[model samples]
Target: MSKQISEITSHEIKVEGKSSVNQKSSVNNDLSVFADGWAIDTAVPLDLKKSADKDYHPVLKAFLAGSFSGTFSTILFQPLDLVKTRLQNPSHHVVAATVNRVQPGMITIFANIVRQEQIAGLWRGMVPSIARCVPGVGLYFSSLHWLKAKLGKTRNQDLGPLEAVMLGVVARTMSGVALIPITVIKTRYESGVYKYNSLGGALKAIYKAEGLRGLSCGLGPTLARDAPFSGLYLMFYTQAKQSVPKEWMQSPSAASVIHFSCGIMAGIAASLATNPADVLKTKMQLYPDKFPNAFSAALYVQQTYGFRGYFKGAVPRMLRRTLMAAMAWTVFEEITRSIGLK
Candidate 1:
């Protein structure tokens, strides 16, 4: 009878063990449901949504952090770009006998512009530059972020370097198109070829004087300089992105660091690739009558100044771009994180 009692207790113990296993399974299922809900609330699937959250307030964020930022930075450092352009423009109308005593490189160019045009002269094309540049820049960033998310199916919402660059192109092209007219105007203004109180005035002046085509006067030179330059800039940026560890990419703050480096590398590369176009653009902007064809301006700069002159103002241009890029990227990240997107 005692043996029988012990055997019954053992069977009961086996039954209790099976019941515990079922209870454990139920807890796991409940945990999974909770986890899924949390993931959805946190926004795990959507990349653009994440980017928007990262942006904080969308257009306003972009305005302050992007276009406005870009424009302000451009203005702050523009004296350098201006002096560079002047030194590199390769003036053709040399007075027959003067021997061209000493061609101003950078310092003389700055002094002469201030002496001749005033402190404001250093920022000659600033209004037009910002006017055209802001809108284009706005389009470039917003569109790129949106389109890359939609097309790439980047489930993680964290873009790799290739993805970032492809998206960058989207924004760049749209911005490029929007800024075409403004670009022409900015070019002219920078070269001291024309002046207008507003972008409208410049457009009106161009239409009245040179016709619609004149508004797009140096399209070939603009495209020639910009397209390949764009490729080079993005490639370097992508490489930078790729080179960094994935862990760094996970940190939103790292975005700014990456962007700053990209801008510096891009500025250097762009200064070289597009120097020829820059020289041509400067010529057409200042003396369209003198250089009816973009090709002619290219030839003139090449023959007169040689290759070194082509890279004129590169130092300041790089400085401005690097600073702006670093600031913009850092600001964008801060804004995004402040909004709790991070």
Candidate 2:
């Protein structure tokens, strides 16, 4: 009886050992399969990952994006720009019986230009304007990004609102310095005071007549106008954008609308604030002999035409600039988002 019982016990033990071995083998096999599948699923090509990662430098991307935005806006709004230039020309006005009759108002001036000079004449300075805007905007955006990066970075911090305004001023000032000549040429061409056969002719004529000074005619006034405009615009836009709800900012369409609305408001405020400087700049650039310096020009305009004169082209300037700002900023923001930049 004892021998039979011992045999049964050994047999049971052998059966249990076999079962444990089988279970272990099955678990090992399942784990191996799972690991293999995981390896296969996760094995994406390095080249593809690298290709996806590669992107333009932020500054260069900003430049290209801004160039496209500015050029498109300039082309579409050239007519408004032309009318603004003509309206801003101090020489065009005739003080007749207390009312400024020769220059008239924005609508009247636009109609007269279309009637007398033809519709195509509204785009007379388009070439110079485009030439100025493309590179000017490119430089402006690139420099802005560069400056922002430099200013924003600290031991462990980023940019604030004040830093943004400072960045805008520096960026605009640098670009303005480089683009003043082209701006002078565009203003003169649009003003109808100078008759040049070609852009080259205008350059030659200005260089011969007034030297390098003529090429940079209203640089001071331009800086005065642009610096404050840029600073205030950036500050206003930044604040306005921050005021939007996070959920509204999440949707692309909603975000675009917000950006555009902020841009228009910022542009209008800046345009109105800086209209006097813009008038002075235009007058000095168009008639350098008549208005030698920015100070003299400002005084002359104020004394001759009074408070209203400072805002001669306010309507067209406001409209054109607001549209330009909205389009440029919206396009630029979209481009940066697509390119995987913040």
Candidate 3:
């Protein structure tokens, strides 16, 4: 009987051990499930994180983003650009003793184009405009970033407003060199001075008539306008962005609004400052024989139309440039953010 009791006791102890082992296993499984749930709730998904990692070189990414942004803005605002170009072109004359007896506004120009040249006239020189803008913006942005990085390393400090301005000037000057030919074509086409049917034809005609010099018609004025314009734009844009509320900066929509507003203000200031150079560029491109150079163009404009000649297209330029800058910078920033480059 005692032996039987011992066997039964031993069996009961074995059964208790097995039950305890099962309970521990269940507890461990529960803890693992809880931990996994916590991680799922708190951690970013691995796939999403990987996707956000930028695969392209930084300069290449900037170039692509800048190109896309510039193209998009140019397409949307080409009509405004055409109007501005016509207004700025010295070759287009507005008769002072016209039936209206008023200076022609953008509305009048638009009406004239539609009446005489059809609505499609509003998109004149769009191809050359796009051609100039894509590579120009791409080089401008990539060079800006590249210079900033190099300068930062050399200076061993964060880029300041002055550095930003210098970077802008250098970048724009470089891009402006490549922009001259396309700009000449675009300005001539928009001014209704050139009768070429296609972009290739325009290029061939310009080259055949005046060779390389004709293609680089407004280079001086272009550099003068673009360099300072870019510098002022970057300075003002950086200041404006810095002025935004910290809390608002955390919200993408709010940040975009700030960017757009700042861009408009910056663009207006820069466009006004650079309007005279822009006018000269247009005149030189449209009538290289007449204007000859930046000085000659400015003198001719001053003699013909007085100080107001320099500001003829100021309104349209402000509108187009403001909208384009707003869109381009906003889109570029968003792209950078999406690619985890910001």
Candidate 4:
């Protein structure tokens, strides 16, 4: 009787083990697609998987990639940035130069800069621009990746439009606050107002003259411009990508084109929506004493340049911002994809 009971128990155990194996096999067979860099690969060695997981640092990689992209785009678009600064400048010289022309367009101003100060003059604030952008964009991407990871949407996962907006806003706000001082310096450097011989000299001058408040001159309007622009841009870009057929994205070139096009569209929309804030931020930063706060700055612009003052640098800004963002995203995506990050 004891032998019969033992045999029955062993048979039942064997049957359960077999059922579990079959279930696992069925599930594995059904999982043909990978998501979030994870897949059930029974054939892969345990040690290899461990190594892969251990070495993968998505946030760090995102920072590096974003820095590279920002450097490239900033260098390319510095001239446009300089022009935008000049156009937004309500300084006597800039206004006087444009006051006589019937249409003082971007091209005309660009040519004048080249002819007057030489072509290199167009990139007047390149050093500070690169300094601000490289770290700024790196921080933005790293924080974005970190936030997404915390939210359990890391790598190869599709974010909803709202999620994208929230992520963009939060990430950009962090980066903006971290780099506001550099941003003020960069703006002054471009405006041709301050004779900041060196970056250090500029910092000392501003600190000695205006103290902490000077360093944080345009904090409010900068945040207002960046947060909403980033949010709207991400929302629009994500929606555009989602609208494309998945089949189309299978082609690498098609995917690149789709991404760049979406970035441009997103940039345009965001730039237009936030142009007023941008104008106000530039005014506040350039003439902190003249326009002490956002309200006063806004009133000054309205009183001085009329209704169109808010969109002063609209053309160059739209072009530079749109192209730069598109290029940056395209480069960032390529770099991340090559490195096996999503």
**lDDT tens readout by residue for model 2, 97-187:** 1264655677777877787789898888998999898888888888987887776663224346797688878899999999898999999
Once model 2 is optimally superposed onto the true structure by TM-score, how far is the C-alpha of residue 97 displaced, in angstroms? Answer: 14
Instruction: Write model 4 residue lDDT over 1-342, tens digit each, in one string.
Output: 999999999999999999999999887665643433456654533687667756878888889999999998999999988988888873464446776644466776787788878989998999889989999989988898899888998577888988999999999999999999899999999988888998888899999999999999999999999999888888998899889999998888998999999999999999999999999999999999998999999998899779898999998898888898888888888888887776
Q: Residue 76 CA error for candidate 1 (Å)?
A: 1.8
Which 10-residue span in candidate 4 carries the lowest summed lDDT?
A: 33-42
The local distance difference test score of model 2 is 0.84
By TM-score, the best candidate is 4
The worst-scoring run of ten residues by lDDT in candidate 3 lies at 90-99
Q: List TM-score per model, in order.
A: 0.69, 0.81, 0.81, 0.82
lDDT for each candidate structure: 0.64, 0.84, 0.83, 0.88
Pairs in steric clash, model 4: none
What digit string (tens of lDDT, one per residue) describes model 3 on residues 279-318? 9888888888888888998898899889999999999888
- Among all windows of 10 consecutive residues in model 1, the one with the lowest summed lDDT is 90-99
- Which runs in model 4 stand beyond 4 Å of their true positions? 1-56, 97-103
Q: Write candidate 1's Cα lDDT for 242-305 as tens digits.
A: 6777787666556667767766776576557666676676676566777888878877777877
Clashes of 3: 0
Show the colliding residue pairs in model 1.
54-336, 140-171
Instruction: Give me the displacement of residue 273 in model 2, in angstroms.
Output: 0.7
